[model samples]
Target: MCERTVRFSEINEIKEFVSAACRCKFDIDVVSGRIVIDAKSILGMLSLNWNEELRVVYDEQDPHFENVLQKYMTS
Candidate 1:
């Protein structure tokens, strides 16, 4: 599994993230505090608090998805 922290500042970013996730064949999860949501679900991502950092967990490596994640990656 691979994990990374990301933050979305706008709704478009979430949409883009979800779009990228949908292209993947493996499972991807977005975690925040006690809440864990599917990365491919736009509604699930919208429900998260945008002010906080989110943890993205995925089972496999895909360069395309990783590239998308780069845009939102947090230090």
Candidate 2:
């Protein structure tokens, strides 16, 4: 698996992020501290309160997953 830190300072950013990843087949998870939620689930992501750095994880062997994740990583 691969991981990266991402910040979503606005609700719209989070929504768009989720929307893009949800279109893919792989699972995407957003983690804050000890809490983890499915990135594709709007309700699950919203429950996290949109106020923290998130750890995004995806299977390492999935090339498409890595490509999707690269878009969210800090430059």
Cα error, residue 5 of model 2, in Å, equals: 0.5
Query: In candidate 2, which residue pairs clash?
Result: none
Lowest lDDT block of 10, candidate 1: 43-52
- Quantify all predictions' global Cα lDDT against the true fold: 0.95, 0.74
Error of 1 at 43 (Å): 0.4
Most accurate candidate by lDDT: 1
Number of backbone collisions per candidate: 0, 0
Candidate 1 local lDDT, residue 18: 98
Residue 43's lDDT in candidate 2:
84
TM-score of 2: 0.76
Error of 2 at 28 (Å): 0.9
TM-scores for every candidate against the unseen true structure = 0.97, 0.76
| lDDT for 39 (candidate 1) | 97
lDDT of 1 by residue, 5-75 (tens): 99999999999999999999999999999999999999999999966899999989989999999999999
